[model samples]
Target: MKRGILLIAAMTANVLLSAARADEAAVRAEIVARLPESVGNIAITPDNQLIFSHHPFFSPEIRVAKLTSPTTFQPFPSAEWNTPRKGTYQYLDNVLGLRSDENGVVWIIDMGFRTNITPKLVGWNTRSDRLERIYYMPDPVTRTGSQPQDIVIDQKHRKFYIADENIGPGGDGSHAAIIIIDMDTGRARRVLDGDRSTIPEDLPITVDGKDLTVSAKDGKPSIIKVGCDGITMDVRSEWVYFAPLSGRSIYRVRVADLNDEKLTPPELSAKVERYSDKPNNGGLSIDYAGNLYLTAVESKLVGVIGADRKYSTYLSDAEMVWSDGITASADGYMYVSASQISAAAMFHGGKGENKAPYLIYRFKPLAAGYVSR
Candidate 1:
């Protein structure tokens, strides 16, 4: 009789475990906002306000914007900040990556690709509705084709890690690396330049049965390869995770080693660990439990690499054309943007195929997440 009871208990436990797994796999993405312009990235202020960048690939009139309603938005910070003034670096030129810290300060990375000026990081205090700071990234720190796309803010250590995907004019993923900024001193350094882990793997990114290609300077067709695109820091700020947009793996290094100026390039490179295999991804975020969330651009889905280093699909939708940027919100949900980059005119041979009403989606996460991370 005892043996039979034990068998029944085991069966009940198995059924409960299976049900929990099924519930987790059933998480669905719900549309939070729809806009006429494609969204480049997404961030949420402490007060739960949605802020996003208008994808620069299409040369948007408004560089950054904040949601006024579910379907409407206005230029963020101000309209003047989005307008380009000749010979001045005060306005936002081209912006992509942005994130809001716990204090409600939204840090924006302006590529400066439009006017060919110095790239910079701009911080706007959402609470005060004022400009907080601006850090210039000049020649040596940024290269000829340096497009600093994504940023990871480590407030605990007063540092900012930026992923520079050298896909600009003279950049062809050859000069890709991480730019470490010391928030305290306003100093920056380019580390792991040309490292294998930071560069793209020789792979083609295909979308909707077509390989994405770009025209070279000589009018030759070449695969569009991007490097060091996605970047995120753990809740503890111990490690910064990053991966190339055209590569199939994620890599990370200790924040301590990256901040140690005494460490040589080779030494820093040696410290990088191949975290997990992933699809070609665009953005990254993390939960407090250490699970890394990735915007799997190629698959039209959001995937999570758990603390155990296993990757699994978290949420998927047919409308998620190019899941560009993702962030963990204070509301216990993860938000992502579908930029529809594959339908852009440049990829479709100069005839913009993207439909209006690009989407921003949110779904519950496995664990609670930090807003600053």
Candidate 2:
């Protein structure tokens, strides 16, 4: 009887010990940079460097910096893309999403629609400091024009899933969908075409807690606008997830179903899955451990949802305003960019000033244990 009681006591002690350690290691934060210019999205390159897309909507250059020493950032040359051969692709209209993978290649989603339908996807070799490859996710309607806004790559498979925002004039929100491209072949195909799963719901916008009305078209004022803005993927399950910028819900669809181009429209739409509710989120990224993280723009908070479906506020603080870009780093940290996009003058008829500025921040997370409430 004494031995049995001792065994039970030992088991109980182990459980308590594990729980205690987790509680001690929840999550930690450190501010990386504060800049006046806008940085829509951030991607940590395989070489352990940081690259961000600059704003002004029509900025011609993309900036690259080393985060090894976060406080001291020096710009690396981007002339590689400016060569005469690269031409028009060299200028950056708006860089919305950035990502890299095990392949050591850096991928950038340049939504050329900074003014119109100039959407494009480009890549670079961080190690060589050279432009690697580029692709135009052809429009599903014209099947010839470029159309893309965000990207989530499966490096192991060399496939990149591109989100088609389709925000051009005279365009319908129906074009919001996913595009899959095999890096090996440069071949691309439209997936989830006109699928309801990827359309934006026009979730009412509120600034300073007040409802704000904005038009989808740049010069024209109108309503009923829809476009997918953020996207990420679960490579293990071959699930590609995306969300509309003005929508309240996130959506997903299987890679296999999307890749089967042979399927008809109604047949493919059936594979679409309405994923989850990630209100006011501007971007998304999945960590190495299968946790999907989202930047809750209006809340100034970042959220993480594990494979178990348990949602947790990974990190939250007054510093996280208009959370724009989010990407996981290698050194036990997740990086975020507070672009304060909502604070942009254009977002609110230039009434709102960018007084809060913008910031890039990161935090180390406690993987398996609870650190705090």
Candidate 3:
């Protein structure tokens, strides 16, 4: 009887494992780049070259890079931009998000945190390798506690939606909002300020059998509340989707409502709609088929929300720890970066515990076409 029960349990475990593998995306993970620095975001140029953002956590050098090989990368644009002297605002500082538009424009969002510099969106032409334009975040909007992390560019309307994580110096991301930028005029405005949709829930994030929080010098964990971290646009550029890293629900608003300059903050807030329930997501992207891809941090999975609003697991694995940034490329590939932030020294001691050689994984998307915004 005991042997029969054990055999049955083994068969059940095998069945469950097979089911889990079936739920994974049809295209498997293809390693693109492996670097010692912690990678934050990813972008694929028109020429199929890979570009990545290095989050200012594990190292100070190499803000952005273009993968020249599997293990080495070249500092993008120039080395001067990555190496900033004291009080130099011209250099890139703590860049977290990046996007490659169809127009051969690579948009980079530099969060002015480490150097107290003004945050800005920089557009560089990949073909020419020239800095095309720079739009500074309005001082008034970024005045108090603004950590703009990710961006979504709407080419149809020539606008940019930036997700202001609003995490303070101490890593307390209590305040959150969305900043809208007019690409043509270089003007910016804030919307949904302190609204429920943009705000984070008073909850703790757990990952890998540990709570997602910062560890003090004394080795005690303190909960860090981050809000409004991921932002993405629909295929038609009609809806802009976003969610807080500490929250579980995804929300979106119509692009037309955002373009209306007459709408006040409260009025814009009314236009926000709760889209769907998601896991704690680090990055969000949408395909041409209106499929939303999410790097679900807490669950260590890549989630997909179809056009029908049905939620399902696209990919999941133990090695997908702290999957940070996800982007769908024009070449029918979806790329994701694993930062391993939860295991960093900040959560252990002054000594970072993150393993070296962080990786970027790419896989074929559900449908072929450029990602929406």
Candidate 4:
């Protein structure tokens, strides 16, 4: 009887493992669009129009673009907005993160690192094809080296939560934080600055058997570290999920607590809950069922943290190099951008190994998700 019991237990475990593999295999990545330059992030408008940012790392002349065909794109909103003019904040200086809301407003975050301009949020109305609003993030709200890369729009609360990685010019990821903006009043404030939750772990990220590094101030190679890079909200907009690009864990806090002005910094910090362990990641998006999907950069895969707080591989591809941004669409698919950042020249003795035709791929999620998120 003891031998029979052990045999049954082993067989049961094998069956469970097989089922898990089959589930992952069912979700395959399908190519959505191909571009000559690397893509930083993606957002699909309510009308199903796809929009993305040409990564600032390469200094592309066309900063923001809309896909007109699978292999072609044009300056988004207008060519004038993408053009930079001296002593003016009217144009997009640098952009990385953007999202479309339920009402068809596409919001883009301009980090302004390229020209030292004031970092700001630009919102364009897709339906009207015109400018809607701009919220300037001046000093005290944004410090030197503030690279606000990702954004989470809460239409229900009329607020915008931005993830500032603090990894640019004068930044070394030491002072990462989340900036909150009031949609109605255009008021913005920095929160959780330098908190343990907003900072990167000391862990070094390795990709393709090589350590990802960049030139330090001393002109020596140093492992790249980024803090508070990805941010997202659940379907209910009750909790804000976030993590560092070089972090080993994901953390979140109640949306109410974060917006409550009465709470002190210590009080707000105490409310943050460590959600789950994660690999080094870039962007985050959540499904209606509360499963948080992450762009697992180092592993060349997309990972999901279920409502039960368990992390698992949802989909993967050997060609999926440095997946940077991800967003759920109304068509019941999750879109991802393969930025190929690790292969960029900066990490390879200034000899760029990045190939053209950077890709955007999509896969089905466990549950339906909003397009704006």
Q: Please give the lDDT score at residue 167 for candidate 1.
A: 90
lDDT of model 4 at position 102: 86
All models, RMSD in angstroms = 6.6, 7.4, 9.5, 7.5
- Tens digits of per-residue lDDT, candidate 3, 123-216, equal 8888888988898996676757788888888888988999988885644566688888998999898887678888788888787676767666
**All candidates' TM-scores?**
0.93, 0.79, 0.89, 0.93
| Cα lDDT tens digits for candidate 4, 80-182 | 9899997678899899999999888999999998977889999999988888999999998999878898999998899999999999789878889999999
Pairs that clash in candidate 3: none
Question: In terms of TM-score, which candidate is stronger, 1 or 3?
Answer: 1
Error of 1 at 315 (Å): 0.9
Cα lDDT of candidate 3 equals: 0.78
Model 1 whole-model lDDT (C-alpha atoms):
0.87
lDDT of 2 by residue, 1-373 (tens): 7534533554454344433332234555578887656666777764557776654332534343334354444443354442223335564455556677655567876555544434566777777767788776545422322346567776546677777666544555666777788889878777665567666675555556855455644856544344676777763547777877667677777877777778888888777776666665667776434456777767777876555444457777686767877776655467788776566566667675565346788876433110000
Candidate 2 wrongly placed segments (more than 4 Å): 1-28, 56-93, 114-118, 138-147, 168-172, 215-226, 235-237, 308-312, 347-349, 366-373
lDDT of 2 at 287: 45
lDDT of each: 0.87, 0.61, 0.78, 0.87
How displaced is residue 330 in candidate 1, in Å? 1.0
